[model samples]
Each structure stands twice: as C-alpha cells, then as structure tokens.
Target: MTTQQLEVNFSELINKPKATLAGLAGAKRILLRRRDAEDLVITTAARVEQDAQVMSAGTRMFVALVRHDTAARSLLLEIIPEAFPWVRFLSEESVRAFAAELAEVLPAAESLGNMSAVATTIAAWQHTAEVHSDPELLAALTTDRGEDYGPVPEPGVTG
Candidate 1:
C-alpha cells in the first residue's frame, strides 16, 4: 500500500458572491464553494508514506466535474481514481472511521446532511486499494501547500 498524491483545479466552477472553505471532517469530499463563473474546485488525494509524504505525489490520473449547482451551498462530491476503483481496497471499518472524521469538518446544513455518509463510504473504499503514481497531483499540492495569502510588503518580511 503506497501513498499517492492527486489534485484538481476548478476555479471556474464557483459562482457565489463570496467563497467559503468547508469540508467533511471525517469524509473524503470537501466543498469549497458554489458553482459560478469565477469559482474553482480542486481536489487532491494521496496515500501517506512512511515519512508522511505522498508516494506518487507527482502523478494525477483522475479529474472531473463532480458537481455543478447554483442552489448548492457547498461543493458536493467524492473524488475517486478512474483507473482504480475504491471498492477494491477499503473495508467497512475503515469507511466508518473516515466518515466520522469528515462529519466534524463538513458544514452543518440540510444540503450537506448526506456528506458524512458519502465520505464514510469513500473512505471505506480507499482503505484497501493501491493508489497509482501521479506527478501532477504532487506538483499542484506541494506548490500551494504552505502558501500565504496575506498582504505583501509587511515589515521585516523578505521574498
């Protein structure tokens, strides 16, 4: 079981007036914002290595539009590898554990009510499967891993 990194950018998916960060604490799906002209949705998944780094962090094989809705408040959809299906690897227990974590992070609302369960199911599936190597995923995630969005030219700060 090797860890892999995956990521997607959907900046064009968001349409809301304001962007909000939201996620399913114990789940796999994390909603960024509602679909709009300027919105983007990026999803990255990886297997944790012994050093906690993604084994195939640089490779990205799966990408798609999980959702497109104006009424939806949060991004709704679980990311899965197109080449390797999750049902092949994860166990029931693993899924439950993952779901529990996601519930704590996801927003609390009627529209997001089912996210917990969905995240749990996805987690269960991922527990057993071997993720492929993806360089694209690694590059994207690593580049913005610790990026700062604050105003520049702060005192004592150097680029």
Candidate 2:
C-alpha cells in the first residue's frame, strides 16, 4: 500500500487559532522569534511515526516552526533546533565552536543525540572551531549559514 503524504504549509497553518491546531493528532507546539522580522508567534501540530529499536516509543516526531519577519533565510535558526532539541544548553561558546567545525566536516546532515548527546558534541565542536577560525568556513556546513545561526551539537555525534 502507498502511504499518503501530508503537506504542511507554514503560512496557512499559522493563521488558525492555537485551539484549532492543538486539536490535531500528534500535535506539538513552539513559539519562534527572528532577528530580522516582526515578531511572529505560531503553533503547529504533526503526526509522528515510531521506530521499534533505537527509539523506546514509536519514532514519529512532529514540530512547530516559529519566526518573525526575518525572511525565510532567518527561519533556518528555528529549523536546526526543532530538528535537534538535545543541543539546547551547550553554552554560547560551545555552540559557536561547533558551528565553526560543522562548517568544515559534516556539511550536510548529521545524527545528533537528544538530551543525552549534547555534552560530548559540544566538546568536539569546540575543538574543531578553535583549530579553524574561519566563520565563512563554519557557515558553509549549515543550510542556513547566511541567516542567524542556532545552537550546535558535538562532533562525530548527534541525537
């Protein structure tokens, strides 16, 4: 059987009231702010699929993207964390270092840990950034380099 795809349009979704979006199955919400745009607060819901092994519960996950008028480019900051919440508290210094390192090595996508993996990843990124002080080089590693950068995880590891 072919699975049907669900398309989520951010512009339309943000219009409905929170009560409406919260009613959906697998709904999760977040508020986003952008450095360049007017404040935009939105809520979203999504269905998650589950994995049998690595994931204790089912592996399906959903998230809400929030941002202001910073242009789609600035929206990238929201995407990084929404994709990897585990790296939230890695310290500003550590995150900058990681972003710099990621600019070099893992330029595409990398698996990061949830709450469990933040510490290790922070250390690795710090080391890499220290060795290489090129902001442009680090920016290259992310899809949103030109926009506001978000938190970074450790090297050789992700949640």
Candidate 3:
C-alpha cells in the first residue's frame, strides 16, 4: 500500500456522520478499502439518499422461516428445495443469511432480481439446438465434396 493509503483510519472514517466532512460533502460517492484483498464497500450518494426498504413480503418470509413461526416455514423449506435443486445444500441458517443479504440489497439492486440467475444459459443452448436440428443443413455443412451449404468459392478453389 502507498503511504497515503496507510495513513487514513478506515474505522474512524466510516464512523464519521453523514455530511460531516466538508471536503467530501460535494462528493457523489465514497469507497472504503480494507486490509489487502479482504473487503471493499462502496456507497453512492444516491444509495444513501434513497430510503431503505426493511419491511417487505420477501423479508417477512425470511423472518418467519428463521423463527420457525409456523407450518408455513416447513412448506417453504420443502417446496424451495423441490423447485430449485441448488437450494438443497443451503441449511435453514444459510437460507436466512442469503435472504438477509437479499433484503438489504434489494432496494439498491437496479434490476429487482429479474435476470439474476447465473445458470440462465438455457435460452442460448435452446437457440443452438434449434440451429442444428435440421439434418439436411447439418449434412450439407459437414460434406466437403458436395453442394456448399454457405457461399460458394471461385472456380479454382476447393469445395
């Protein structure tokens, strides 16, 4: 780290009240870097200015599930696993943690969890399947000495 970077006290920096620093008052965003590659936190002016959504239906589910309030939690624990196989490894505590993070960031998240799934390559794979489904086109492309499937070359060139 540079001397300038090592000089600041991040703990105290973050402890400062909002709008306390005159120099940074006009800044649109701020970021704090922790030891080495350990952690990073960035807070935008807009994110801080916007209201946080603490109470929502999704958050209520997490709270209820964590407290084991009723049979509903049991149904969720079973149904979620059945619907999403990836949820199989997540215990109740892990699910609670995930839900907590989700709730905390949901408001700041730009997409509202529309296309958040990482395993969403099904559409790309489906397009590829459709492209290669025609046997005649596939055979024509693979055949070297037959009618060309794509643009044909000049007379002297090979097929």
**TM-scores vs. true structure, each candidate:** 0.19, 0.22, 0.23
Query: Would you list the C-alpha lDDT of every candidate in the order shown?
Result: 0.36, 0.41, 0.47
Any runs in candidate 1 off by more than 4 Å, and if so which? Answer: 1-88, 108-128, 131-159
* TM-score ranking from best candidate downward: 3, 2, 1
TM-score of 1: 0.19
- Summed backbone clashes in each candidate are 32, 17, 0
Candidate 3 lDDT by residue in tens digits, 22-70: 3244443444546665544344456443523333445445655645655
Local distance difference test, candidate 2: 0.41
Ranking by lDDT: 3, 2, 1
lDDT of 2 by residue, 55-117 (tens): 422122211111223443244444555654544544556554454443323212223324234
How many backbone clashes are present in model 2?
17
**Model 1 lDDT per residue over 49-147, tens place:** 322222112111111121234222122223322333553344545444443434333333213433455455455445434331244654565576676
RMSD of each candidate relative to the true structure: 21.2, 18.5, 17.1
